[model samples]
Target: MAEKIIIGITMGDPAGIGPEITVKALSNPAIYDRCSPVVIGDACVMEAALTIVGKENVKIHPVSNVDQCLFTPGIIDVYDMKIVDINKLEYGKVSVMAGDAAFLYVKKVIELALAGEIDGTVTNALNKEAINLAGHHFSGHTEIYAEYTGTKKYTMMLAHDNLRVVHVSTHVSLREACDRVKKGRVLEVIEIANKACLDLGIEKPKIGVAGLNPHSGENGLFGREEIDEIIPAINAAKAEGIIADGPVPPDTLFSKARGGWYDIVVAMYHDQGHIPLKVVGFIYNPMAGKWDAVSGVNITLGLPIVRASVDHGTAFDQAGLGITSELSLVNAIDYAIRLSKSERIK
Candidate 1:
């Protein structure tokens, strides 16, 4: 038997589904079997969440330090920021207070992980607009982690089961994303993707690199990016003994990846990678008039500490309804534990 990994979970925007899902996920007894989880958010929000999610029996225990956590299943130990004003808090609306608190919670978790207080960190969804309104100018969690950890080369990896995709350039304009796809960055991402797969215990990982233009630039007809940049990167990766394939047609790359032809796909840009992943991970039931499931894990590769996040955003429309899926968050926690355990072994 192994010791449980300590995972710090950042509660996202209070105006969203963060608190509700945190309580819902914690109610699972199996989670405690693998990790000692703590919520870094307002205790009041969590208390109210317990009621909203109908998990009132689960107590919210506030602890100033990780050492103080009981790590018990039914008791949700929270490193309470004591921030949110429960009376003023309203679901489905963004406020500066919620935004600031969300940003601060992430900051504290990052600090703790850097200090070796926790093995890994898992974050719920936070509103980008709200955070920007609150004055923290981060693009997303990946950017925040890279800046905090002082990591120069890091990429976002989104996973839903076996179909994993890593981006060459994320959180950038379409034109900029195309411009950013040079041989150097492409090669860097390939190397990172190879290392990530290896870390995940995949032996001799098969990587499929997607092209920037249609039909891999149609032999320089549609564009010269594949001929000028992408091919050189693939050749460079192959020379280094990495089993990387493509400038596969962007249209068919995902289908082949999903068919198990490749262990991972290196996407040229954000939407190129995200659209396919989401198409597979996010499911909605029109008949039921609700989401059947939202599943995926967002991982930041090449960071000093382990970090994973739910693939979905702060669902403002479904905030207090308490009907949001915890599948993504649960998967994120599992990924964090796996990554942390692997890091520890190394």
Candidate 2:
């Protein structure tokens, strides 16, 4: 029998729901069947999380390196950083200690992956503001991965089941997002999107490219971005024998993608892609006054190492309550495993 893939999971900001969800997700014996999951963060934080999430039966095994991991169910091996101060830590609030710990955790996981100590990595959500306060200065995990791995051309891919969307430009202002749209960048994203689908075992993936302007610029009526940039990129993708479609109107493109018309949609920018993906993935129960499920996977395509993350944030309000959903983390581990196996095949 083949060995289970080794997946390194970064316990995100110590003050957030990261540790809570990490313990909850690891409590599932099914996950151990697929991957040797290891948490790269403070063992003390994880210990507290196990109790908070009511998984006290599960043990926290601290390992300084990958070879030390037992890789067994009911035993979550933490590659302990021991950086977070449990006494100083407060659920939901931002702190420099937590921020620096979060940054270091991510950095260590990337280092482990680059060194081939792990097959893939899954990340819990980290607070951007907190990380910056710690002086890491990274915009997000994608940027951190790109920098540490020396990947130049990469895009964020968010997936909920069969629905997937890749951004041409993410983490930029609306004005900058519009200005960032160009034939070259759009084509680059389309190419990446096509390859991403192929990686997911989609044969002859149909790529749907979205327009910057509404109604896809109404054929130059609403805006010329469609004619000037997006359409040309689609045509260029076609030239490369990629089954690329649209400059489809932003309003309707996602609906078609969700209905299985396209394998993946190439969004023009950050919110353009995030809004629709979240609309489908994030479910809130009004009567219960809590989320029923927050399920989605955020993948970084074109990275040297496989990385997938929970689509939701730290959920500061719900952190210590142990009510934040671990479904997204479960989904992320599944993706990381699949992507790692795919890499092994390659």
Candidate 3:
């Protein structure tokens, strides 16, 4: 095998399942076999998770840099962010301290990836409300990565198996999000999805765009956004030699992508894309009111550094609950390794 890939994993909000998932994900021996992973957050919180998950044998090796990591099977290297108070941390409660720590970890991870300190990043879930409480005003992770890396063109790509979708505008209100949909932004998103597919080893990515309204505006009957904005963007992308087409029905486009007819589906908004990915990822057992198998990964495209995240949020209700699934976190790390390997090849 080639040299091991170094992936920096970020521990998100201490008030949530971030710590738990991070610990449980790394507990798998296969993870170490694939890549060298490091945690970039509070040691106290991770210790608590380790104890809860019954992985007392796993050791957290404190290291100063990625190069110092041992890359061993039983050791999880940690570059402590040290921005939390374990004593004051209460599970399932939103606090500014937790938010501040999460923000710092994310910031530090971005810096490390940009500086070539690590190959790529995989982040656990962080609460947006808590992040704002700490006065780090931002929409979400995609924006944070974009801002710190000075990346003007960026998009959120959510993936599960062969199904992948990228949103044009995420983390915006319904009214404004609809208004923001124009030919330029639509074309930009199409290009982003296309380029992302190429990086993922797709020779020619075929993208299908989801409509903003019912039946793609029924020829401007319900809405003209499709006729005026979406279709124009699709044409522009095709002109650039991109295999792009649609303004397809929002409800049916994903079905086509899932069938492997298209490489990815470009969603107009957040829920339109997220709902479908979750349909396959978010599997919960109602008997205990907890997810049994949480899986998927969110990759931010067009950034200076590669950043992937668990396709879930800060489960405030399941903060200390042993029920939190570590599957998503593991999938995120796997993606980070794949992305890192691709980068190295380039």
TM-score of candidate 1 against the unseen true structure: 0.98
TM-score of 2: 0.99
Q: Tell me how far the alpha carbon of residue 114 in candidate 3 is from the true structure, in angstroms, after superposition.
A: 0.9
Q: Best candidate per lDDT, number?
A: 1
lDDT of 3 by residue, 81-104 (tens): 777889999989889999888899
Model 2 residue 321 distance off true place after TM-score fit, in angstroms = 1.0
**Each candidate's TM vs. the true structure?**
0.98, 0.99, 0.97
Cα lDDT of model 1 by residue, 275-341, tens digit: 9999999999999999999999999999999999999999999999889989999999999999999
All candidates: CA RMSD (Å): 1.0, 0.9, 1.4
Candidate 2 regions with alpha-carbon error over 4 angstroms: none
Itemize residue pairs with steric clashes in candidate 2: none
- Candidate 2 C-alpha error for residue 146, in Å: 1.0
Assess the local accuracy of residue 249 in candidate 2 as a C-alpha lDDT between 0 and 100.
Answer: 86
Instruction: Give the whole-model CA lDDT for all candidates, comma-separated.
Output: 0.94, 0.93, 0.88
